[model samples]
Target: MSAYEFPALAIQDWLRVFCYDSYCADAMTSGLTNSKDTVLRWQLAVDTLYRLIASDLLHIPTLKADDLSAQKAAALDYIKSLAHHNPFSSDIEETSHWYLWDISATDRCHRLIEAYGIRDIPQGELSQGLVAALHNLFAENRVAWSDQPLIAVSADS
Candidate 1:
């Protein structure tokens, strides 16, 4: 499979679980809060988690509160490790490149989220479903993070 194939399929599967799971569906429509800002924050949090997974910086078998917290920290540490390897000698160039990369990563992350129908979710229930769907995805797939390039397999294989 191509690099995008596996993650795309995995994400789709995750979405299916999120949409169909009773708890998740309830959370999505529960009218828990009317605050748009709160909803946005929840969305951002979900996006961050998904970005880490997509970037292969995080791997876990579930997104229970404690496990999610621990893995998020680990992923942040991994990011810090990468930052320590600044390629440019000049501070200005490094800062510029960092922002550029951030912009690119954000764009990609948003596209992935939107393409998966995640962006269409009602604001109030976003937080309620966040952990559950991710937990289901992790439990079902037990995704493993790797920096290795994904190789394409021949159709016959």
Candidate 2:
């Protein structure tokens, strides 16, 4: 499939299996792929991911050259539009989480357009609960993923 046809978030998640924890920077397992020859393994892992992205074309070597510049441009342009209103920006090549980027964009869009009512239920608690549920979903849906319960304690109460 054309890279453009693929979800940017999926590509990004592959880019960063560790999700931003500095501890996971070099932890490429046996099945994990690494393309870079320089620096630490973690850096290499990140570079490998970036190379998959920002390529003018997906250089499969076996596959015939199909100039996907137009499609790539369109996808990137759309992503840039998402980034336009958020704190994140797309890089030439990113060796990190794309899922977070897209989600951040989506959440930002929701924030911009949606109005919330002040409620008796604490938003913080609700947000945390939703986050935990989403984490469970991710662990279940992903092939080999697991997570611990996230606990948040606040002094305000």
Candidate 3:
């Protein structure tokens, strides 16, 4: 497979394994009190990352060689797009909104796009870097989730 095809397929496989499979669902929610809420947060994080990767792929062809400004613009564009959302009123919507906001604020995602725009990187190296960055992104999100209060408290109490 070509460089593009490899990352696309790898991302699809990751989505299947983490978002679609029952095993990951169980693992992600296992020690949490608000299991359902936790699951939703995890899914949203994964989905957001997937969207970022897809957007980066789309911008690759437009990237100009040796043009730092174009590369930075692509990265910034990815961050900007991820931050867009309707004003949220409900709990789930609010959760997703902030979740995405937190992700976009991270420098790692920005660097990933910038690195992807580089012209001289070997295809194999690029693919590896993409895969590694994605894995780190997911791991970091998972860690952030784990640091939150696992048990949901009722306001009525």
Candidate 4:
């Protein structure tokens, strides 16, 4: 495709396997207007992968390790914050709400790339595929970076 749009075959395959399968199921159940939770879950999976990459990019500590539960919590909180601030957060037709999270995710990836001046981002046959897919979707980094890192305390806590 475009120059920024990397042809990550592994990621494209993973998206078809993990995200779209559930997305299609949810869309069918609600006449193509599935619940926000359905879309949120998909976006969270994408965001979590990007956040993991960001952790590595910034040399941030990773207490969560491979467990992205904390990242999930932060993502939900970030979405909630978006819903509070953005009037179109509820507009699913515009691909707002959960889908709009890509703006933030992409911006994060672009920032990481600029910060490190990395030409080719690393990828694994297994894990990095998902991150690569996210990078593909949000190819253009439009959103501005924030000074404060996104973090949310789980409801369980």
Candidate 5:
């Protein structure tokens, strides 16, 4: 692990590596790649996040009341926006908005949506679904402050 690498990374990229490894033999990947600034890119690229979770390596942070309230407000507004507006047929368009269209139906995504009350980012790459996705995958400041103790573990986001 390079000194430049942090122990944490964005959840989407982390999950991407997990999926890549889950389906492909040898995951057909280095299982060790991440965005340049992203730590644990190299070693984690090969390992599935499911195993990491099972082994107690990855920890999802729980949001506080304030955070949850904000997320809920955002979500309600987003749902209102989505009313009668389908990505498939809606006039509004954004390319990155729908990457997880199929994956959104997964239990994991549903868990996030339920957990975070996520709606939309309202800023960079903000889409209601992506907001839900981020709720599931992304880490907050608490992730670093998590009570879980990690030692002798290879760094990955």
Candidate 6:
């Protein structure tokens, strides 16, 4: 499926899973808590990378070739548009705002953008709740990936 075809709920999962805390802090600081615009900006950042990775013709080894030039141009346009949101700008001062970069880098999920020097997202402050959520997501998902013995296993024990 194309990256644009990626489900909204899945995007939301990535947002919450990857960068919820920083977004919350920014929202609270800017007095835009629960703002739709803030959420949309975050989604745009996510979608740009998702699109690049999902592009059928844009493999990494041949990035210098002209095969996916049109697709690459479109993706770069998305990044440029995403930069207007302040948090996703390439400027060092705005690095903290690059939540998508932080999210993907922290999760070790995708680094193609960083590898290409497209953006730099410095680590941002994370709240205790966000830390806990990240831990839980990792722990639970890891258990689901294997048939290894699970400690404290019980539905309601």
What lDDT does candidate 4 reach at residue 78?
A: 44
- lDDT, model 6, position 92: 62
Clashing pairs in 3: none
After aligning candidate 2 to the native by TM-score, how far in Å is the CA of 75 from where it should be? 1.3
10 residues in a row with least lDDT, candidate 1: 22-31
Q: Which stretches of candidate 6 lie over 4 Å from their true place?
A: 1-9, 12-66, 85-157
Point out where model 3 deviates above 4 Å: 1-108, 118-126, 143-157
C-alpha TM-scores of all predictions: 0.25, 0.19, 0.24, 0.21, 0.26, 0.21
lDDT digits (tens) for residues 2-108 of candidate 3: 11122333343333333222221112222212234534434343344434433442122333446845764654453333333321225565334333221211243
Question: What's the residue-level lDDT of 93 in candidate 5?
Answer: 54
lDDT, model 4, position 43: 34
Model 4, range 1-157, lDDT digits (tens) per residue?
2211222443333333332122211222121112355433333333333433343321112223355656545544544443233222345543343333332223444454444333343433333544454444344432112222233212222
Error of 1 at 47 (Å): 12
Across residues 12-90, which tens digit of lDDT does each residue of candidate 1 receive? 3344333333221112211222344433323322333344454532333332336655755554443333333232225
- Rank by TM-score, highest first: 5, 1, 3, 4, 6, 2
Q: Stretches of candidate 1 above 4 Å error? A: 1-51, 54-81, 85-90, 100-117, 124-127, 136-157
Instruction: Show pairs that collide, candidate 5.
Output: 31-45, 31-46, 32-41, 32-42, 32-45, 33-41, 40-155, 40-156
lDDT of 6 by residue, 72-145 (tens): 45434434444344553366655443333221223322332233222233223333443343334435544221
Our tally of clashes for model 5 stands at 8
- Please write out the lDDT profile of model 5 over residues 62-144, one tens digit for every residue: 21236744643443333223222222323345212222111112345445434543332221232345434443442531223
